[model samples]
Target: MAHHQHHNFEVDGVDDDEVPRNKCRTCLKQNTLTIATVVGVIMGAILGIILKSTKDKWSEREIMYIGYLGEVFLRMLKALILPLIISSLVSAIASLDLSLSRKIAFRAIAYYLTTTFAAVVLGIIMVVAIRPGVGHTEMATKQSEDTRNVTTVDTLLDLVRNMFPPNVMEACIFQTRTDLTSPSPNVTDVYKYNISFETVQNTNILGLVVVAAALGIAIAQLGEEARTMANFFHNLMSVSMKITSWVIFLSPVGIFFLVAAQVLQMDDIGSVMSRLGFYFGTVCLGLAVQGFIVLPLLYVALTRKNPFTFISNMGEAIATAFGTASSSATLPLTIRCLEDKNGVDRRVARFALPIGSTINMDGTALYEAVAAIFIAQVNNVPLDIGTLIAISITATAASIGAAGIPQAGVVTMVMVLETVGLPAKEVGLILAVDWLLDRFRTAINVMGDAFGAGIVYHRSLKELGLLEQSSEEEKFQVDKNNHIDETAQ
Candidate 1:
């Protein structure tokens, strides 16, 4: 029989079984940032409400001043995005075998598509059941003459064109988008318009991801020759992460001004709520179902882990997403939370999260589906079964093309309306509340990305272990051959 030995030590005259004060202090210290963020949200909301009760209305310039801190925070986060995506993706993929990388990519894309389709279906069911727009009366609003002539074919082409940027440097600041230009006044056919591909002032994230993946694959193939290059990106990723950590510390303060400024900028909240309250409620309910119920069940079923615990680990990132109202801006925090707090692997987190943020828009898909159907109902247009199916398909496709910025979903919402013969100008009706809804959907988008990373990491564990083992075996063989050659000589 073997006996086990036990040793006990007391610190500062405390007994072994007694809880130490330092432990409690350390736990609080660790969670201080999260606590501050919650406080900021509550304080900001209260301050905004109090200010709204005053007689004076806030001007645009005044609103800008109020949100100045938030502006700085957003700029800081956006500035880091380009480097973070490139460095993280390149470094992570370069370390893996080509076959393993392929497996991981396939798994991620499958998960993204599945979740997005589910969100679309859920939104459609909620809108159909709730019937929020059944009794709404159309208001008289001026329609802008500058209607964008967007078609499904043109949109799909633009997606492909942006994926393969002609100039890598230009892609950093501009992405290619097709626009329909009206013919000259003297032209006989007024309906015929020229289709011109123009550059838009937005970061071409999709193109960057594709380029980075190719570069990483080339490096992996080069083996020892690309070791120095791989090291550079690895170090670059580390430095970017460090800077992101520092910026994240400012979130509580930034979020405070952001929420306050958003509240101040609204006009006649009572009137808008009276008219659109049901629509707002419907959207919120769908988002809640997708975020709380659908995503958790998927996570639990796939990983067999406590989804709530995983979500709790990602609280900071979700809160930041709500404050910023832009998933692109929230990418840095999402990556950090997945890797540092959620125990997801660096390789999986880096490789999958950027791609997910760019493409996996579960909340956006749901919102668009609901908004489209709501518009149809408001116009008294009866949508047949075929039309409903069209809405579902279009909403899902449009969301994939939507940018991860604030109000980007509205841009894609135009396509959904046009597909189902709804007036595009009806979008104005929802603009008043879109700002608030954007924040909620963006939070859900970030959550979906985080969940995808966790699932990918879990699924890829076997391949990752095998790759590591093979590398070790290869190294041993090389050493053994060298020893034999030296002795023979």
Candidate 2:
């Protein structure tokens, strides 16, 4: 063979000879955020342990001071959420035709329900097999005085009520919650409960989502008349995203203080861990199976791509979810990672993510299922197949209604306990470890949302391509007609 020399040519204004170096630099720059987040978590833990070991005990106010930065970061993220959800959902749905929008909605909901059910089942299997609470019956006798008198029906009704808030503006700041009060606290009659629905200081996300979807649909139907409105929402979404990006840059510093404060606030950690170690391990195991094995498999089966690679690309979002312990807080990063790093369509990311953050709670479902069973074991309560089935169903449903905030699962866990005749206050048993577990499960929840976006994006590719082609053709025809009219004039 004759010797030959090849010269590299520039493509897209970049020399091929420097491509490898450029790629390496680009990758490092991209991952800087993930690296810093990891470092922040590690440093926070180290600092907390150091503070905990000191001779002087830390006060509540001191711990609050430590977490002030984290609190500000959280508030900033939440401040953007109302605008982000409204703008993103309205813009995403308005951009699509009705049929395509319905198809995507159906797929997203189907994926969410399937994954959540699977998670509940997996958690049941883990708790049943591990038997983490079998030997802890003694602690069950020490019950707290507080009991949630709400029934499953009441919980279900609350879910529906929150979905249709009476006032759109009120939904921005409050969600409806049913409270049970008794005129006589000393009287121990459960039937004497009086129910009242009152607004709580929480964003009615479900209601807002419903309103946004309707607005988007209406805009879509009005055709060209609604162009200005649609454009307004689209521009609003862009501005919200820009603000979100700026907030995310503070994650490392915020997370450091958050983790440190959490550690400083712990009480008798050694004793709590000794008693709850197996329970903690079991919940962690279930989350790992759901987040790592189950979700990734679903993604691979649907997309025929390496799911781990997709997960790897979501490092920053997952880390933020863990550090923040709120999927709602982590929403901005999730959307960014899905669209920018994973190559998901903007329409799919925007449409699927906000809804997923609200309803798709695989981690919460698994944790609640496991915790309910674990509580049963702790109390030596005999549970039949029917009871177990009720637990699974209730856990799945409750997880859907569960808020995307830290420890929201604790509130819903009471319903699961009461459904099977377990004491509502038995939740106190898991309170000590719930803080740590919340972070893990929140990370899994965010991962599930990201995977759902990827799956929906993969499944809707053909429809999206068709929509794009039709849009281009319509634009061409409009321009042609305008040209003819101009020439005639």
Candidate 3:
């Protein structure tokens, strides 16, 4: 196998330790921003605790304002998710030749499906191991007219149905980009991160993925005729990623504020931590293992590439997703990360990732699987192996049905509960504490996409000799390849 050059420039004459100083300096700024954001969360949580605990009546008004700041952050990030996916994907897949397209799709889909399956299994296992919901007392359930957004027997069927274009105008009419809606009269008390329709249980992200993939395959199959449109999308993906990279450099401020805000308000932080701690703990453990372990392993099995190199290149994209908490929003960054940072062939990264974004959800799928089983345990329902297997499949697809935002997993859990015939009301229990876990799951979902791209691209590059299969990473480096022109360098 051969290779292509990868570059990171430094100010001349700098010591090796001093080399990372520039990058390190930026990291320090990011770390500082992260600390500040965590402080903000702490302060806000404390303020909420104090206001609720000390006063005769808490100001709904103050909660509204504070919540709004979080909303603003979500909105800006959400605003970028859809276009980033749509444009980047169209461009990425379209530009590939048929030889590359097959390799890209084959490996990407394999990585996605396998890793997703593992994530959900892990989620279910961890939750069952800990039984976070078992023997747990709870706030009384909300009054139900049975009109709430719970799942139904028909929900999975409906989820598949919704992905296709019932009407071309639907995306715009429905506000496809952001998940949260503006607050108005009756919706005032709850968090405004609205994700579901009152009557519908599924959003059919799988349908959208199917459509995009069909289009990409068609374009690739058509050759020169499709080249113009393909190039247009490729360019779009490229530009979006450049923008994504730019956005990445600024994320420390956003993350810091977001985290700080969460931490600032701790009323019996200990008790709350103790109470919901397992839920958070399980989610984190699952995501960390899936994101860092399972997904990387999938890459190695599929493409035989070094996961560390893939991780190194994908840093900016992953960081952006962690901060933004939306894969669609991170699309630009993910595409850029695959092509620019990692040595993925352009065509493969474009085609697979966009499709993966809509359908391949390692993190959300895992959360859904775990949450459903946990809810079943709380309700004292028995889950056999068959049921667990069903859950693995349903949760995998349901993750695509779920939106990529706060509380998305809970909403998707509605579908999973229905699949296993659990009382949909149990979802409210999970919902009560889902916000914190949602962020971690979203990052897991993005990692799935990043790793999927890496695996597929690695396979493609290997076939083309764009990347060599080394006996070991220590034995090879990209600079040895002539693909990167030295004069152009």
Candidate 4:
């Protein structure tokens, strides 16, 4: 007989055994991300500096190829976006009981909105206190004349229109661009040639999610047919995740090229930093407060569990979020850790994580608030109390629709900026550091999703009389469970 010895480590009253062993594929992928992040940062910085210094010595072809490598990597990540989201959403919804679905969905969105609101408020306070954009007058002059000037009413209409695309297929397959001359133009030349002041935000991810979710819910209502569709979606999700694993393996190389290209494009990195350092610092500080302080406090308040244990278990998901700079791409891993490792209920995790990934923008909301105020400050636009409040509201709304991808906040930041009459083009000031900041924001976003999942799962168990329930409550839940079982059978 083989003998097994048990080993354990305890920290802060939580046993190490509470965390599942790290031999699983989730842990392996996370470790890969952690290593890739370190190696990629080192390689990116070194290669960026070298290429920037020797730019004149290299041929144009070589530089283009280097940039192309990074572009290809981004395309690879984008490739996973549709398939992963559709499959995951379908599988997550199909796995849940229909009645509990609404309850979980409401709780998840409520948690998401709460965290995002707090984040934006924190960001406003930090940027107001720090005043990051006070002295950078030169950056104000670098504006693109093409920035559209729309009224509040117009912006509201645009937002509504974008939320529901005319055709889900057009929304999914179409890629919106300001440059019509580029390949894969989705619209006619009228909007593409930059002749019209109107712009269409082509990546209607919210619309795609809405369509997929509707399909999933419909599939769930089909009873036995639901099982067939559920199996298909489950299989599709498995296949897509395998593809994601392959793509993630290339993260190190992708990060190096992306960062290097980012560096080479900058004429004077130091000058950009000196001007935007305060803005960047403020955003990071706000993110840290939200990720480390606010969200954990909420988690403890809800679950009465150790935040350290929760975060430790989430290490892989967080690492993957940072490396990919995407919550959507990291959704599979996040769901895995929450379900397989942390014991979050499948219903709660499946419902919360996917919805959270789509709309939960704690980090993005914080960044948008800071960026809007910073831009206003940089451009010498004084914001009154009323204007500040408006900015806050707009930031939250804009973040709801922000795509869970790298630098997605910047695109939506324009909406927030427009709310306060700031020059949308002044966003150029912070473009240099956006890539670096993106990783941090993505981490916070994923953490928020996990935290929401934890709270929802606990509440679900509580409702089932599994935790801290009276005898009457326990009996009530037992009857409810039997009823559900009979219905299922």
Candidate 5:
């Protein structure tokens, strides 16, 4: 063999020794954090089930310790949530090209509002049929004075109360901050002593969202300097996610506490569980029917695609949603699910999901409608035509407030109750059962994310004439090759 001669290209700045490299530890750690979140959720849920069921056999201190640990994980999540929302939102909307943003916005709104409206309507139907709230006695009202606790008003007053934002920037920042203090990242901070009615509050979700959306939208119209400023916020968003990932790693311990606490206080866990079962069953049936019948029907009717393919491709996202009750946290996973599995173009997935996470709370919408009626029935609050209309509208708006955040529906329920003159204190009655229902709602929320992806993909495919008979041929080939390889081995 001849001796090899070295090659160099100073002019072209070429070097032959460059080699493919492994990913950095940060990326690997990011992945670990993500996967760990799912694992923690599963393990925590399992441990919680056992502890809750065997509460009598366990020490009170043990349960409390676990509960506190779970709470700690939740707190960590909250720590990152606010800045993440504001910064990511500001950057996302700010960075979008104006025309594309408009296009995305139009499509996003069309999909989100329409789906949420459908969910609310479905909720109304389920709650009406089940009448969960009708039989239960009205719970004790809050002894303290709080306008938010209005239990005896109609929907009109709640509408008035929620009509406007106080201070846009402050609202979003404070909302983010307030949610941080709760076990739920997006929890409503119902103060023990009510603030003076004269004091203006900025914790309203609608107002906060509105403010964030406005500021975000406004950034695009800002001068060049603002764009530079917006870039900084983008950096902040990334930092926030980093923090969130770190918090998620310790989730197992935090989850233990949350589960332990709930199980600890119950005198007859079985009876409480029976009620929870009924509530969860109601929510699950509603979600299943909506996903299978309604959304799929929309997909089939509107575009040429197999809905089953869409759902199958979104498995990982659904898994993530099942574990983390927050839709915002699930956004990155949802987009990845669509791009990597569903074959959705990144442009659409990226453009659609963040907005969807913000406003497209189809799962919460369903809960609100269903819950409003359930609570109404439980309280024996009769609903005529006007009240029903009020229920539908207020519930729909409150659903917007649901924001894929934690226990968001509960606060929304309070919004509905305050709208319909029900005592806010009645809100706690639903809390005990809310956790189980929250899981199903999360599944549906992910389903909605997947559905939106399907809609976007279907439309794009049709526009490009890419729709064909099916993907079965390639799938068949892959299956056959796998089988042959297995036999050879």
Candidate 6:
């Protein structure tokens, strides 16, 4: 069998040195997280422990002030989540060739659903096997008064209804707060509660995604008439990215206070650590299975390519995702790695990843399922097969709205909890470790995106009659052909 070399369309030189240095630096930078992030996390953990060990040195009022300021930084990150998803997705869609884009979109969605569903099932299995939340009764007892439950039937109905927003502005900017007790929720209570995506904040991200995608499709249909709209979204994406950069500069300071406050609030750091440690171990295990075992195997089976080579090629993108904890922010690097390093079609990467950043969140889906069930287990809420099935569905659906930014997993996990009669406030239980686990999930999410690009590019090649069959399959065919020719002769 002849081994054929794939050409990198993005780079003409065909030389090692011609490879981009920025991406090369990605691999080198792996051991070093963003300097500020490392400093902040380290200092925050130390300060939190010190404050915990000696309360006389730090006042609760001072901690509260620090936490309040830190929250402002979190809110800034949340504010960018929606704009980034919408603008990037809309711009990517509008800029694509509709016929090719539709094919790639279908494949991407199918692949995403398959992987996300698998991730959820894996999470459920892990939670059941490990039973990490079984003994954490205290955490469950602290459930907020706002905990609400809907029937399994209503849960499905609400998910579908919420996906299509009646008012896009309200959906993106303001979320509806439902008071389960009242037939008509009290007007004052509704007016008083303004939850964005964090801390009971409800920005209907799924609805926003639907609206953005629909607008993108509409703009694409307009052909030349849509130029201005397409350009507007492109520009908006640029502006949102710039804002994200400025916000990221403050992450170290914000993370320090956020971690310290969460730590200080825990009455028993030892107990908290034990429970969170189990949960963390479960999440990391799920991520490893999905990112390492499942996705790579899938790529090998689909493309007849060496999975190790694929990973090696995607190292820079993976590192970038880990360091930034933002798949959307890592888009430029992911695209370059796929095109220049892995020989993935530029069109496939362009179409698959922008949407994947918002929707194809295998890691987030798995985490949500694990978190929801973990919370339920701690609360002693028994989940039957029906309920677990509902959780799997709800987690997959809710994850469609997951923003490709750090800590967004915690926000979207609320949807899964609400579907299962758990309080959204339970999210605070895992908030302390979310920052750390976020890097893991973000890296997995970017891995999924890169895998999607590779698989889709291979499929496109086969469709165009360009891709070769595996060596064994080709050899068998050739042997059969030779036998047939000999008999005829």
The order of the candidates by TM-score, greatest first, is 2, 1, 4, 3, 5, 6
Top-scoring candidate (TM-score): 2
Encode model 6's per-residue lDDT on 1-489: one tens digit a residue: 122223453244555565688667775564233455656766777888887787545566877876786678667766676777788778877876666667767888899889989989999999889988888787634443334533334434555666786788778765443333333545434224432322135666667777887888899999799899899998997788677667766766776777677667656657667768898999899999999999989998998988888887777567556645677666665666787778876546756776777688888889899989988988889999999998999888767766566677775677788767776778777776776688788889888888987898787774323223454678899999999999999
Candidate 6: residue 37 lDDT (0-100): 61
Task: List candidate 6 stretches off by more than 4 Å.
Answer: 1-43, 54-60, 64-76, 133-140, 176-179, 182-201, 242-262, 275-280, 303-351, 371-387, 401-489
Show model 5 residue runs off by greater than 4 Å: 1-42, 52-61, 131-169, 172-227, 237-267, 275-277, 300-303, 306-309, 312-317, 339-351, 379-381, 418-421, 453-489
1 or 6, greater by TM-score = 1
In model 2, residue pairs whose N, Cα or C atoms come closer than 3 Å (at least 3 residues apart or on different chains), thus clashing, are: none
Cα RMSD for predicted model 1: 4.0
Q: Which ten residues in a row have the lowest lDDT in candidate 5?
A: 173-182
| Candidate 2 colliding pairs, count | 0
lDDT of each residue in 223-298, candidate 4, tens digit only: 6966887899889988987887777667677767776766676667787777778888999999999999999999
Cand. 3 TM to true fold? 0.74
Say which prediction, candidate 1 or candidate 5, comes out ahead on lDDT.
1
Error of 5 at 412 (Å): 2.6
Residue-level lDDT for 40 in candidate 6 = 72
Model 5 Cα lDDT, one tens digit per residue, 1-489? 132232234423342233222335544543554465556566766666676675355676766676776556555655554565566566766766565566656766788889888887887788777766554563433332323433323333343444354556555533321111234545554433233333233234445444555677777788485877777877886677666555655654554455446555555657666654555567778888887788888888877689887876665566556655667656655666687667876545655666677667777788777766666666777788788778788777776655466666775576677666676666665666676677678778778867886686556553323213234667888999999999999
Return the number of clashes found in candidate 5: 17
Predictions in order: lDDT: 0.87, 0.91, 0.64, 0.76, 0.63, 0.73
How many clashes show up per model?
Answer: 0, 0, 29, 0, 17, 3
> Could you tell which candidate, 3 or 5, scores higher by lDDT?
3
**What is the alpha-carbon RMSD of candidate 2 to the true structure?**
4.0
lDDT: worst 10-residue window of model 6: 190-199
Predictions: Cα RMSD each = 4.0, 4.0, 9.5, 7.7, 12.8, 10.9
